[model samples]
Target: MKKIETIHAVGHVLCHDVTQIIKDKTKGPVFRKGHIVTEEDIPVLLSVGKDHLYVWEKNENMLHENEAAEILFDLCRSEGMKGSEIKEGKIEVIADRDGLLKIDRKKLFAVNSLSEMMIASRHGDFPVKKGDKIAGTRIIPLVIEKEKMERAKEAAEGGPIFRILPFHKKKTAIVTTGNEVFYGRIKDTFGPVVKEKIAEYPTEFLGQTLVDDQKEHIQEAILHYIDEGAELVLCTGGMSVDPDDCTPGAIAGTGAQVITYGAPVLPGAMLLLAYYEKDGKKIPIVGLPGCVMYAKRTVFDLVLPRLMADDPVTFEELAALGEGGLCLNCGVCTFPNCGFGKGVVY
Candidate 1:
């Protein structure tokens, strides 16, 4: 590495090893604020003369490099904070409750590690809207390199805002279809059981229709809800290979693409998925096997959140869901936020 030097001046200067300030010699040096001259660099610094030996450092500023970057990530990527590029060295962040904060370029270069300098928003939940103040970041000590500050400022620019409208509450439609249930011989115990499990949500009554060993009618009813804006359509019973068990057949008739007819999961192995586009919006239809009625957890436990989310369900997404899709069927069921389908960043 090319060694540079500066001479002693009227004021003290801060000097740290070149390797400490710069990760790679290729990247060059970044001096933080409030630094003072040291004897280690005295030989080099002396060559530059007294006045030129002055080191860049200060106390009060909007943000230091590392601190500013951390704050920007928390706001832009994690907390959905809004910011605008004012200039090469300037970024302006405005919060509804916290007011406005200005980020200076010089301050960013004054800090070490970006993680130390960044500030995240207070909000932790997803679906953050615009203008939310996730966190506040600022650099201490003023003087810093122009390029290094620019790099830090650029990272704080913009990021994804996982926002979705809560206009429609999640409502489930339960359809129980089987020749036995239609004949009214064993009593429809499955319908009530499925209802009890999802009772946490404000599930609306979408009518329980009894179909006699017919997949056509089952598929027709599923399509009816898709047209009527049903977020989830659950088909109970008739998921087996028996000719009379036509629930899978009914789901196939909907003209919607089915991601999986069955999964490797237990209890709900017979679960199926069919998706259709209704006016450009993707509609997800789930075929719940008879096991779901009795089993504590099933594939239903896994795909519910993704279905409720305002996003289209794809084969890749469904396949990825299989990892945590199996239910341990623990002594008790802690649903909605369970290990089966832990939350994923959208």
Candidate 2:
């Protein structure tokens, strides 16, 4: 750090905050610490002080915090992402569009391991909107060694360390299976629930097919939706072991690849995930357990964004969710922001 005449301190970052005061009116920082001095700032500093200011000094071996932050930003910079101007030596990376955020957690960890620097971000595979703050980078010290920045650059060499997979608009169809619903004994509530859950995604409900627990009827509905150009087919109810439950059988009967008959998550543990092939490309078909109709959030909530981005989940990945599978069922459901299904990432 260096102390210089306030007029000549232009272009240097402040080392300490300059407090401003007015009798009984205000007494707070006029210029925050780490603010870069500008030509206009001279008069402000002169008004607060006599003539001198403390500022960061240029050095060959040690780089200024802003410079270090730029290098870190460059390391992870990529399409669909942009960084803000340096503020207090910190730079925040933001998403450029609505999509599923993918974080290179392994590489992200490596970069943070370096001393005197830090990077923090939201978990990967979550949905994000335009301008959402994905990550932030900055140097811990006012300045850092040039070599540390080089190491960070090397750690994030390939494509951006963070990226977004844009969601593809999909025409969707729903199949509600249950003797009660099919026979009109009880109202079909599952169809509306599924639609509400996927409201944010680029999806439209083609139509709903209410059918009995007949496996053949369920298979027919799925095939009909695929024929109608439905990219996603969601089946609700009849997922339990009872003889009346036949949604899983119906999905398997259509020759669709069943990825998992049951997941590790509670409230949606009986969920079934599958893929149906039409022509050459495969379409996703999900069998929703009864709990989905009542639960505010479930495993389905955790996987919806990924599906909308067309990123399919694997059996092992769903199995691993058992770690953070149990929900606390808090009175106020914060969901995605909460700990439920966090195991899906770890």
Candidate 3:
């Protein structure tokens, strides 16, 4: 790149995007790279306080910022994701499908540690929608050493820095227990709520069995769903310590690996989570507390997306939810978008 007086820069290409900042009113690029400066543009350029300008010039050792940015973009593109067009030496990574985003954070830090380059992304393990901006990368200079970009590539050698895990279709079975609903004393609210939540994913409630608060009946109903090919078993109600509440134990009686019997998040603390693995098949069993039937959002809302994506939850992971677990229960609840059960940093 070469520096020249703005008056004498006519016909010369602007080497970089010149952003015009008008206090808080506006701040955006008015002159883009490769744009030929004209005599008419002199006043506009001077108005933006550009007395001197950087013009494009070829150099073997130094690489143009656009070329350098694409190299950084290539380092972040994985399957199920694509990149936006290079804009002012920056390219944004976007999700090609709606799914959970997984980031190679350790390698990401290693790459950023290399000078003159950066890769910024959203937090890992979060849900994302198609066309969502996942990350953005740029070369930190108008021009940079070719070797530095190559070094950044070496630092992120494990493939792309991130990938999207698309949600899988699962055949789910919901078993709502409690004598009040089983005997028609109260309407079955939990069953409809679970159905509505899982409907957001590529899943279907194959069936729902309404059983009384009897351990034997609840156990039998759950096993029947598994034998009928239910990949996800959902048990609602009867999760608390009440003598009549028996869903949590019924789920355990199936000989499943119970991950956690209680959660830290508000609105769903009594929730039970477990996994049944046999003959190479793993089915997740959840015993949702009664709070789920009332709260608009809870731990169930937070973990449901991950489970639908076929991402198994570890006991350690559930324990990490305490930090961002408390729900504000705002007047107008906006879950998933709100911080309710967002989980904390480890």
Candidate 4:
């Protein structure tokens, strides 16, 4: 840092804040630290009693906080994201569209581990709306060593650390499997609940098929829907381990690769996920447990957004959810905003 006359400080970065005092109205920083001195700012500095200013000395080996912030922004910006204008050595990553947010946790951790720089973000693997603030980046010092920023870049080498996967419109079909519903013994309440939940996404409902608990009947209905150009199929009921519960077997009989039949999550532990491959296309098929029909939030809520974005869920990822799988079932039910499914995988 070097001292320079306020008049000659134009185009230089302020090393410290210049406070302004008013008789009774206000007394605060007229110019914050890291503010670039401009010709228009000179009069304000003078009125604030700053005859001279301490400014950061320009150096090739050191980077101003704003410059370092740009570097951090580059590490996070992706196709569906935008960066806020730099201010006070900080830049914010914002979503350009509604989608599922994915974060490379390992790389995010490594870069933040580097002292003097930080990238704070919302939880990953969840839905984010347009214009949402996804993350923020900044450096601790007024200026940082250029070499340290280079290491940060290397730590996040593969690509941007954050990405938004936009939801895709899907032609979806529902298979309601239960003898009581098929035989008109009980009201089909589950189908209505599933429809309401899926309505949050872009979907074209292809009608619901009611089937008895017979494995062959359930399998036939699933195949019929796929043959009818359904991009996604949801089967409700018969997910338990009872002798008559044959939804899981029916889904397996359809030749879809089952990702997982059970999760470590409450109200959704019996969930089944699978994908059917045909003509170079993979269509998703899900078997939802009973809890999804009555519970305010369940494992289904945790995985639906990801599925809507066409992001695949793995067994390991589902296993990691065990840490935060138990929903408290709050009276207000603020999910995703709650800790129900926010366990750290790394």
Candidate 5:
């Protein structure tokens, strides 16, 4: 840092804040630290009693905080995301559209391990709305070594550390499997509940199909939906281990690759996920447990956004949810805002 006359400080970066004093109106920083001195700022500085200023000396080997913040932003920005304007040595990553947020945990950890820099973000694999602040980045010091930033770039070599997969419109069908409903013994409450939940996404409901708890009947209904160009098929009820439960077997009978018939999460432990590939397109077929029919927030809430965004859920990823999968079932539910299924932090 070097001392220079306020008049000559134009284009230089201030090393410290310049405070202003008013008799009764205000007394605060007139110019914050790291502010670049401009010709128009000279008069304001002099009025604030700053005859001279301490400014950071320009160096070819070093990057100013704002410059370093841009580099960090570059490492995290991806489609469906935008960076906030640099301010106070910081930049925020904001969602440009509603989508599912995905982060490369390993690469994020590697970059954050570097000295004098940081990147803080919301948990990945969750829903994010447009204009939401997803992540923030900045440099700790006023200036950072250029070499260090280069290493950060290398750490995030493959692609941006953060991504937002926009939701895709899908033609969806629901098959409610239960003899109680098919035989008109009970109201078809589950189908209505499933429809209400899926209504929040960009899906075209292809109407509900009622099937008795018979493996062949269930299989026929599921195949019928797929043949109708349904991109997603949901089977509600008949997911338990009871002898009459036939939804799981019916889904497998359709020759779909069942990813998992069980999960570590409660209220959804009996959930089944499978995919049927035909003509190069993989259609998802999910068997939802009874809990989703009545519970305020279940495993369905955690996985629905990813599915709607066309992001496939892997077995390993589902296994990681065991840590924070149990929902408190609060009287007033605040799902994604709460930590119901955000356990596996890398």
Candidate 6:
């Protein structure tokens, strides 16, 4: 690549299709991709493309390919960099090993923040191993030399401290309980509601079972799900303290520790949570209140996120959900994301 001594700032960068490439006596010439052009190449470029060749003078702190790619990705996002006109200020770069380095719009391109640059240090496809740093990020000032930038990018590339997280689809299970539903009294409306909500996530049903309010029957059903490969077990109904409401007892009978029998939330406060190890693997069992069947939201809203997270639900964690656990049932319920309940992050 040939280095140019200086460049002329054409009034401004060109936009849209070529308006006109009129011939000029200056004999400016045009250079194609990979062409090493110096100051002497300017007049030649003018001749080939005619008088004006939409050219942008290089900046003293020009960003590298990967760095420029992050800027472009950020520019295209909803929270994109402000003041960057999509047409005039966009720069494109190829993706790296860890995919494209996307920059957040709120993150200003400060010299300090750009210290660590993610680069394609090694060559290969994905499925990179653990402890293998496919990409790295650091913050350095803009005063670094060009040769220094390459060295920094290279050093930051190999054995990076951080590795990209592998995307894992959320898995869930549904367990419906109630003598009325199990015995076909009310036609089991709760099962479908739970299914509808569970379907919204990238999860599988795993399996579901309908059992009477009998603690033994419900316990067997809960155990069956655990044996079948269900990490998250959601049991609807039989959650109240009424004599017939034995879902909580059944869940507890499964030898799982109940997190909380009651919560500060309304409509679904009569919730129950239990966890136990069967064959060395932990299983989560939830006794959903009757309100979950008809109410808009409740404790299930709080428990759902924890199940989807990489960690298991604990009594202390479930206990903290009471703060935002209450359900208002406002005129318009934009649940999960609204301020109504604890707001489960799907």
Give per-residue lDDT, candidate 4, residue 313: 87
Ranking by TM-score: 4, 5, 3, 2, 1, 6
Count of clashing residue pairs in every prediction = 36, 0, 0, 0, 0, 17
User: What is the C-alpha local distance difference test score of candidate 5?
Assistant: 0.90
The best candidate by TM-score is 4
**lDDT (C-alpha) at residue 23 in model 5:** 90
How would you encode candidate 4's per-residue C-alpha lDDT over 137-170 as one tens digit per residue?
8888888999999999999994599999999999
Q: Which scores greater on TM-score, model 5 or model 6?
A: 5
After superposition, the stretches of candidate 5 with alpha carbons farther than 4 Å from their true spots are: 1-12, 19-28, 34-53
Least lDDT summed over 10 consecutive residues: which range in candidate 5?
337-346
Model 2 Cα lDDT, one tens digit per residue, 1-346: 7778998988888876789898999998999877898999889888987399878877798887878888888777677889998866799999999899887877888888887888898877789889999988888887789988888877776437888999998999999998898899999888888988878788877999999988899899999999999999999988899987888999999899999998889888898999988888889999988898898888888788888998878888798889888988999988778778877545
TM-score of model 6 vs. true structure: 0.51
As for TM-score, the candidate ahead, 1 or 4, is 4
Clashes of 6: 17
Model 3 off-target regions past 4 Å?
A: 6-12, 19-30, 36-51
Q: Order candidates by lDDT, high to low.
A: 4, 5, 3, 2, 1, 6
State which candidate has the highest lDDT.
4
lDDT string for model 5 (155-197, tens) is 8884599999999999999999998999999999998889998
TM-score of every candidate relative to the true structure: 0.57, 0.85, 0.87, 0.92, 0.91, 0.51
Extract clashing residue pairs from model 4: none
What is the Cα-based TM-score of model 2?
0.85
Alpha-carbon runs more than 4 Å astray in model 6: 1-173, 342-346
- List the lowest-lDDT window of 10 residues for candidate 1: 97-106
The residue-by-residue lDDT of candidate 1 on 1-346, one tens digit each, is: 1123354422444423222323454443333323455656555444333334334344453333443444444433322234544222234443433211223223333332443234333322222234654344444323334454455555534332222223235556777787787888779888887777556444565656666777788877787777666767778888888867888878878887888887755657777888776777666777887787777777665555445544455555555555666677777776534556432322
* C-alpha lDDT of all candidate models, in order: 0.54, 0.85, 0.87, 0.92, 0.90, 0.52
